[model samples]
Target: MSKIKTKFTERIGIDMPILGFSHSTDVTAALTKAGGMGVYGIAHDPPDKVQARIDAVRGQIGSRPFGIDIMMPKGMPESETLESVQAKLPQANLEFVEGIAKKYKVPEATTKTFYNTVLRSPSYFEGQLQVLLSSDVDLVAFGVGLTPDAVGRLKAVGKIVGALIGSPHHFDAYRDIGLDFIVAQGSEAGAHTGTIGTMVLVPEIVQMAGDLPVLAAGGIGHGSQIAAALAMGAQGVWLGTSWLATSEHAQGDHAIGDRLRGKLFAAGSGDTRITRGSSGKPQRQIRSAWTEEWASPDAPEPLKMPYQHALVGDLMTAIEEHEVDPLLHSPAGQGVTWSLELRSVAQVFQALSDQTIAGLDLVNSISKSP
Candidate 1:
C-alpha cells in the first residue's frame, strides 16, 4: 500500500524503506514496531550480553523482522593475546591519554572489568556468530568484511546475509558470494567508512550490484535524502547518526544522555571529521579535543584494529565516568545538522515517510507540468 516498497523492504516485511542501525535494543524494537526495520549493532558486546540484548528486543517486538550487525575483520593476526597486544602499544599513546585525563581533571575510573574477550581469540568471534545463528533473528549484517564460508553458513541456516561495502571493487568481489543485500556506506557515514561520498558511491554500487539490493548510507538524515537515495537506485536507506538524538537511545545515564543530545543538537554539518585516531580505522565522529589532540604532530600513530580499540577501552570508560565533554565523542555522520531536536522514534519514522512522499509527489507534478 505504500509507494516506498522495494524488494529489500518486502523481503524484510517492513512498510517503509528505512533501517535504523542502533546499539540500543529499545531503539531497534521501536523502529520495527513503527514499520521500519531496526538493526541492532552487536559488534562490541560479548556473546552473553549480545544474546540477552537480542532476547530483550525479541520480547518487545514480537515477530516483527529485525537484524543484527557485527564487525568481521578480514585480516586478523594469526595469533594475538590481550597481554601481547598491550605490550605492543607505544608508550607515547599511553602518555597522551594520561595528559588528556590530567587536562580534564578526570578522576580515576571505577574498577569495572572491560570486555575484550572477543578480540582475544578467533574462537571468540566464532562464539559470537554461533549465538546469532542459534537465535531467531531474521537477518545478519557484517561490516568491514566477511568470508564466503561465513556467508554460506548463514545462508544455509536461512538467515539473510548483508554486508557493507564502500567501493565497486569490494562489491564485485562479494556480489557472487551469496550476499542477499549490500549496504553502500560512504565517507560521510559514521563509524568505520571509506573515502567515497554517497552521491557518487550509491549509483556506482547500485549498478555494480545488478540484482543484489543496495542500501545507501551516509549523509542521509531526513526524508529528502531518502527520496534522493531512491532516485539514485538504492533499495532503502541505512541510518545511524539520526537515531542517536532520538528518545529511544540507550543512554542510561541522564547526564550522559543530556550531554550527547546537546552536542548533537549544537553540531553543524561541518563539525565532524574522519580520523583513524579513535578506532584505528577511518571513522567520522564529532570533532572534539580527543580527535584534535590525536591529530597533533606530537601524537603517536594509532595502532591497528583490535589493538587500537583495546588501548582506548579503559581510557574511554574513565572519560565517560568523568563526563569529560571534550573527550566524549560518538560516531556521527555529516547528517547531524538535521538532528537538532530530540524526538521520539515514531516521530522520526513518520517525518521521514511523510517527507519522502512529498518529495516524490513534487517530482511527479514537475514531470507532468510541461
Candidate 2:
C-alpha cells in the first residue's frame, strides 16, 4: 500500500489512513504490519498482563506505531472485588441474571470471567494507566472515562494521546484536554456511543477541531465511506467493528472463538441493538437472546457501570464458555454489513485501500471534468 498521507497517518507515521481497534493483540499487530494503526483494547485485561501484551505487539510490529485503549467508567469504587460487588447486588438484579442463565441453560464456567479481574474502580484504571505511562507504547486513547491527568502523564512520557468522543458536548469537554487526535464516534459505532450519526457528527467535529487531526469513526465500512470521511474534512478513519470479523480476530479462542467468529460473519447492519446490556451504556451489539431478555418489559432497569458488568460477568463467561449460540454476541457497528465473510486483515486492508484510491480517483476526475 502506497502511503495515503493524512495528518493522522503522517503525524502518527502509518501507511493507511485507518485505525483498527480490537481486543485481540493479533488484530492489533496485524493492522500495524498491514499498513494501518492498531490499538489493542486493554480495559478488560488484568493490570499485570497489560505490559505483556504491549511487549508482544512490539515483538510482532517491531517498533511500528500502535496503541492501547482503556475504558474507565466514572463513579466506580476505588477498588472492589467481584465477590464483594456480587454480594451487594440487589436480589432482583441477581435473579434476573440468574433467570437468563437458566432460560438459556448456559453451562457453568470452568474459568474465571475476564470482567471479574477488571473492576471499574479508580485504582484499577490507575493500575492500567501506570502500565501505559511506563511502557513503550506509542499511543494511548480513552474509550470511555477520560482521566484529567492521564493525557498529561502520557504526553510526559512522549506518547500521543487520543480520545473517542460521541457528541459536540463531549468534544467541548475534551477539546482543551490536550488530545493529539480526536475520534468522532457517532452512535452508529459499536459500543459506549451516543445518538449522533457519523455524517452529521464528523463535519461538526472537524470544523470545531480547527487544526487538530480528526478521525471519523462509526458506520465506516467501505472505501467510499473512507473517501466520504475525507471529504467531510476528517483526516482519517477510525474503524473497530469491521475488524471483529477479520481473519486475525478469528485466531480461534481456545474456548469458543470459532462460534463467536461464525456469529459475527452471520450478522448484518440491521442485526444490532443499542442496549445497556454490555456495560450499562448504550452500546450496539449483535442482537441475542440475552439482549432480548434484558429488553423485555419484565427485565429490571439495568444497573450502572461496574454493577451491570458484574451482573452479567459470569453469565457472559458461561455463554462463551458453553457456546450459547442464541446468546453469543460482540459489540459491532453497522459497518459490519460489509464484513459478511472472513478475510485476512491484510486482504481487507488492501481492499479498503484500493477502493479508497479508486474513490479518490473518481472524485478527481469529476472535479477536473467540471
Best by TM-score: 2
Across residues 89-112, which tens digit of lDDT does each residue of candidate 1 receive? 788888877787788877777745
Report model 1's TM-score to 2 decimal places.
Answer: 0.94
On lDDT, the leading prediction is 2
Candidate 2: tens digits of C-alpha lDDT, residues 1-370: 4678986788889988999988888888989999999999887777887898888789899978999999877788865787788889999988988888888788888777575455578877888899999898999989997877888889989999999999999899988888999999998898777999999999999999999999999978899899989999999998988788777776632222777778777778898888897688888888888778889999999998888888888888788777887998878888888877878889889998998988888887884533
Least accurate 10 contiguous residues by lDDT in model 2: 249-258
Q: Where does candidate 2 clash, by residue pair? A: none
Give each model a TM-score.
0.94, 0.96
Instruction: Give me the displacement of residue 273 in model 2, in angstroms.
Output: 0.4
lDDT (CA) for every model shown?
A: 0.83, 0.85
CA error at residue 108 for candidate 2, angstroms = 0.9
